[model samples]
Structure formats: structure tokens, C-alpha cells
Target: MKVAVYPGTFDPLTLGHVDIIRRGAHLVDKLVVGVTTNPSKEPMFSVAERLEMVRREIAEIPGNIDVVEFDSLLMEFAEEQGATAILRGLRAVADFEYEFQMAGMNQQLNDDIETVFLMADVSLQPIASKLVKEIARYGGSIDKFVPSAVAEDVRRHLGAGSR
Candidate 1:
């Protein structure tokens, strides 16, 4: 069976993320969403919270998708999960440079694993987890930026009531 690993911090999975996850699911027999911690940025949500949020968001998606948490290198995680590819989302040119560099390094580490990039939907292209948290932090409406399940969590995390 062909398996793909979509690895990301996913502090709070946004609509753009959902778009990618939905599309990536169809390309592989199984799509494992790997929620990991990024040492470079302090996340607003805990790893467990992120995993739970992603699971809830994808529970109804029509595919063999599962959520997993990891802290080690993505390549190692992919190998451990028997993944044939690593799925990533490309929202804009800004995302390409960093993803490109990481893709090269990941390839060097494991040539057998392929990296697949899926462009975000036009309407959801600007959505990002960091920006979503920022908007929510300042009491901005995140209903359109994230999934309904995630928006509630974001509102609660930011200490805001129902919107």
C-alpha cells in the first residue's frame, strides 16, 4: 500500500491545511498527518491539542487518513511509518524557498522517499497557522481561516467567547 506522510507543526490546522490534507489523501492509499513541534517557534497549542484538533477536523474526510505526533526528524518518521512520500502544501512563492530547501535535504537523507507539493486553493492561499493565531490573539475573526472545530478551540485558547 502506498502511504504518504504530511508533516507539519499544525499548531492549529487552518482551512488551507484542510485543503491540502483533503487533496493529498486521494493520492495515496493512506495519508498520515504528522503533527510535530517546531523548536523555532513557541506554539500556542500543545502537541496533544494539535493532534486532537487535526483528528476532529479530518474525522469526516473521505480517505484513509490518520493523525500522529512526532518530534524526531521527518524523514525518520516517514521511514518508521513506511511512507512512500512526504506531502507538503505550497501557498505562495514565500513557501517555496523554505520547502524547496527542506525537500532537497530530505531527499538527500532518503532518496527513496518522494516529496509531493500541492498548491493551496486560491481563496485559502493566504491562511497560515501563525497568522491565524495572531489574528485570534488580537480578537480577530478566524471563522473563515480555520475549520469550525478549530475555530472554537482558537477562540477558547485566546480567551474569547462564541463569535
Candidate 2:
């Protein structure tokens, strides 16, 4: 089976994240959505919350996709899942710079697993979980960036109802 691991914090799955998940699924027998914690940044949602949110968001997607929580190195997680590829999405030049370095490091760790990049749809390219949280924090609508269900999740989490 051609398995790919799409790893991310996914604090709140955005349309861009969904876009990549949907598209990446077609390229592999299974797409493991690895939900992990980034100690460098404070996350608005807990690891459990993020896993549940990603599970809910991708539940309707048609593919053998699953979400798993990990706190160790990404390459180790991917290998544990039997993934032969690591799927990623690029939104802009900024994303490329970061993903590029990460991919290089991942390759060094495991040359057997290749990293694949997919560009988000033009319309969804601007949507990001960080920006979505920021906008909702300030009482702005996030319906455009995230699904209605996720928007509600964020609003409920932030107690910024119906903005």
C-alpha cells in the first residue's frame, strides 16, 4: 500500500488544510493525518481537541484517511504509520521556505520516505489556522477560512459567539 503521512498541528483545520487532505488522499492508499504538538508555539486547542476537530472535519472526505496524535519526531511518527511519503501543502513563497527546510531534514532522517508538496486551491490559499484564530479572537467572521462546523468550534472555544 502506498501510504502518506500528512502531519500538522491542525489546531483548527482550515479550508486550505481540508483542500490538501482531500487531494492528497487520491495519491495514496491511506493518508495519515498526524496531529502533533509544537512546543515552540502556544496552541489555542489541546492535542485531544485538535485531533477530534481534524477527525470531524475530514470525516466526510472520501478516502482511507485517519487522524493520529504524536509528540515525537515527525519521521518516526510517519515510519510508525508505515508511510512511504509525507504529504504537505504550500500556500505561498513563505510556506515554501519553511517546508523546504523541513523536507530536507526529513530526508536526512529517512531517505526511503519522500516528501510530496501540493499547492492549495487558489481560493483557499490564504486561509491559515493561525490567522483564522486571530480573526475570530478579534470578533471577526471565520466562515470563509474554516468550515461552518469548525467556525462554530472556534467560536465556542473562544466564547466569541456568532461573530
Candidate 3:
């Protein structure tokens, strides 16, 4: 049973996030979507809200897929969750640079764990959670860049002016 953990803030899962998860799903027996709570980063949605939104978005994903929230090092989280690998989504060169560093660190922390990178779908390459939230905050429609569940959550959050 090969399990892979995909960790991210997932402040609001974007279409790009969905694209990567769907692609990574085919490569692993189980995929755990780990939403992390970053202290420095102000999230647009609460952890519970993000988890619910992810559940709604990935409802069609195979039963092997799981959604959870965490606030710890990626390597530690993966080990605790019994994940044998880490899946990362690379959208551009900038992403590669950052993921590369993190992958190296994770490898150092846990030799049994490996990191796999999946390219984001071309159509969603430019979409990001931060950008989606920014656009929606200014009253711009992100209908195409975000999943329906995420869009609804974004709309609800923005409506109440809660960040």
C-alpha cells in the first residue's frame, strides 16, 4: 500500500490544486491532501472551512483519497500519517525552485520518504489560491479558476469580510 501525502496551505483549493491532486492520484495507492495552518500566512478560509471545501471538491476522488488538516513539518506529518511519499504540484519554474528545496529537506529528514512532482494542467497553470482569493475579494469572478465548492466558500467568506 503506497501512500502519498500532498501538503499545502490550501487556503482555498484552486483548480490548479485539483488538477495536481487528480493527476497524482493515478500514481499512488492513496493520496492524502494535507492542509497546513501557516502562522505567518494569513489564510482566507479557516482550516475547518478549507477541509470541508476540499471534501466537496474531491468527493469524486477514489475512496483511497483522504483529506485532513495539519500544523507541522511536512516530513513529520507524512510519517505520522503513514505516507510513504510526498506529492507536490509544480506549476512553473518558480514552483520548482521552492519545491526542490523542500524536497531535499524532507529527504534528509526521512530517507524512506520520497517526493514526486506533478505538473499542473496547462489550463490551470496560472491559477493559485492567493490569486483566486485576491480576485474574488475585489469582486472579480473566479468561476473558471476555482472549483464550485471553493467558489462558494470564497464567496461566503468574502461576503462576511472574514479573512
Candidate 4:
């Protein structure tokens, strides 16, 4: 089985993320979406909440996609899951530098695993979880950036009226 691990904090899954998930699902027998916690950034939602929200958003995708929470090194988690590859999404040139470095480190840690990079769709390229959260912080609409389910959760957390 060709298993691939797509690891991310996924604090609140945006549409760009769903786009990558959908495309990545087609490339592997099983795509494990790792909902992890990033100590560098303060997340608005708990890991449990983020997992639940990701599950809800991906419920309709017809594939062998599983959502799980992990707090270990991504390469270790991928190895534990028996993944043959690590799936990542690239939005632009700026993202490639950081992603490339991580991919190299992951390769060094586990030479058996490969890293696959998927380019975000042109229309969704501008949407990012950080920017989405910033917009939601001050009552800005994120309806276009994230799935409705995620937007609702963000709105509820931000104490904003539902649209």
C-alpha cells in the first residue's frame, strides 16, 4: 500500500488545505492528515477541536483519508504510520525555501521516505491559515478562505454573529 502522511497544525483547515488534501488523496492508497500542535504559534482552537473540524471538512471526500492528532517529529510520525512519502503543499516561491529545508531534514532522518510537493490551485494560492485567523480576529469574513464548517467554528470561537 502506498501510504502518505500530510502533517500540519491545521489550526483551522482552510479551502487551500482541502484542495491539497483532495489532490493528495488521489496519489496514495491512504492519506493520513496529521493535525498537530505548533508550539511556535498560538492556535485559536484546541488540538481536539482542530481535529474535529478537519474531520468534518473532509467527511465528503471519497477516499481512504484518516485524521489523527500527533505531537512528535513529523518524520517520526510518518515512519510510525508506515508512510512511503510525506505530502506537502507549496503556494509560491517563498514557501519552497522552508519546505525544501524541512524535506531535506526529513530525508536525512529517514532515507526510505520521499517528500511530495503539490502546488496549490491558482485561485486558492493566496489563502493561508495564519491570514485567515488574523482576518477572523477582527470580525472579518473568512467565508471564501475556509470551508463553511471551519468558518462557523472560527466565528463561534471569535464570538461573532453567524452569517
lDDT of 3 by residue, 1-163 (tens): 9999999888888888888888888888899999988888898877898898888888897558899889888888999989999999888999999899988888899999999988888888888888887899889999999887678878988888785
Each candidate's clash count: 0, 0, 0, 0
Model 1 ranges off by over 4 Å? 160-163
The true-versus-predicted C-alpha distance at residue 133 of model 4, in Å, is: 0.6
At residue 53, what lDDT does model 3 achieve? 84
Scanning candidate 4 in windows of ten residues, the lowest lDDT window is 154-163
Backbone clashes counted, model 1: 0
Better of 2 and 4 by TM-score: 4
Compared with the true structure, what per-residue lDDT tens digits does model 1 show for residues 1-163? 9999999999889988888999999999999999999999888888998988999888888999989999999999999999999999999999999999999999999999999999999999998889988888887899999988788888887774432
Between candidates 3 and 4, the TM-score winner:
4
lDDT of 1 at 10: 92
Cα RMSD, model 2: 2.1
> Each candidate's TM vs. the true structure?
0.96, 0.96, 0.95, 0.96
